[model samples]
Target: RTVTLYAPASGIVLEKKVMQGQAITAGEELYTIADLSDVWVDAPLREADAGVVATGTSAILDFNSYPGHPFSGRVSYVYPTLGEQSRTVRARITVPNPNRLLKPGMYATVRLNTSAQSALAVPQSAVVQTGDRAIVFIDVGSGRLVPRAVTVGRSGSDYVEVLTGLKGGDRVVTSAQFLIDSESNLGEAMGAMSGMGTSPQGKK
Candidate 1:
């Protein structure tokens, strides 16, 4: 039995490879059309950063063709293979283009919004970095500042997740974290030196 492949849908011929009666075979792609509605973007991410990426992650797509306009999309599929030269994985995201404003080969910036949860978080200004650890000053009461170490997780521009060493409803000194950090360091140093007159085993 012989079958003919008709144009999928009637639209302007974006690319025509065969003429009216050119020989064609089944399952052969001969023509391409430009349907700006419902487009796909090959969002790329570094291989090292692929751990946090997963399907269904919300994303915002920005196209150079339509400046100042952002389209919403989601992580449809993540390519398993990595680019040999760039060592980057191209995660495929589908965006609805009902306005037909997006075109093929246009540059796009894909932004991923991670999971949201009710975790103990503090203002960005409340955290201070001391070498590899993060420290924050908590206002216990009566203008007392208590310095403590905290484990942090995913952070946004205004808030940082406090993974440990903090609980909900704890008031943190955000404006004076740096000053508190200096005080904590001075206190620790004094304590360490105070026992210097003792044996080394006592210091430990």
Candidate 2:
């Protein structure tokens, strides 16, 4: 008996999984099919950004090749695992490709419109992160910086919303914050050492 093998979808053969005259079993993969009916954009969202973005969130996609044209889509799935190295959560956005304009390998930038609210915020670069804690330098007085511990809620490219440990009308050190953080930590360490030296236990 003569048998004919057919690809699943009418598309280009991306990779040949089997060789000619090779022994193959039933339900084995022989060819790779590239289906373009629905294009999926697997974009990675940072840990902070992922926390705000939810499934079914609307997203605007802009491709470099498309120039002015923009594509709209909704997040279909959010992977349970985060990227090991990048620490980003993977999200799948399904874009209808009836026109077949968007390809699978196309590069795109996904802008997720997250819900907004009023909150205390500061420049993202101003906060210095140490281990799992977030630290910020406050301008207490002239040429003086005080390190304050803060809890951050949501973060953006330029700004981060502060959940607590800060108040309004407080001056924060945005520029050269790392230098100030180092100095503040050093001062605190020295003060603690000096206090320990003068304690009654020091004479024991």
RMSD vs true structure, all candidates: 8.6, 6.6
Candidate 1 per-residue lDDT over residues 136-187, each given as its tens digit: 7666666455666799875666987787999888887776434634554436
TM-score result, candidate 2 = 0.76
Show how many residue pairs clash in every candidate, following the order shown. 0, 0
Q: Which residue pairs collide in model 1, if any?
A: none
Mind giving the per-residue lDDT tens digits that candidate 2 earns over 1-204?
558977666976668988778888998888878877778999998886787777899899998889889999989999999888998999999887788898667899999887876789999887877679787767666455566779987777799989888999998877534453455544552343344321111110
Model 1 spans > 4 angstroms off:
1-53, 78-92, 96-116, 180-204
As a whole number from 0 to 100, the lDDT of residue 145 in candidate 2 is 55
The window of 10 residues in a row where model 2 has the poorest summed lDDT is 195-204
Tell me how many residue pairs clash in candidate 1. Answer: 0
Residue 84 shift from truth in candidate 1, angstroms? 16
The lDDT per prediction is: 0.71, 0.76
In model 2, where do residues sit more than 4 Å from their true spots? 6-12, 17-25, 178-204
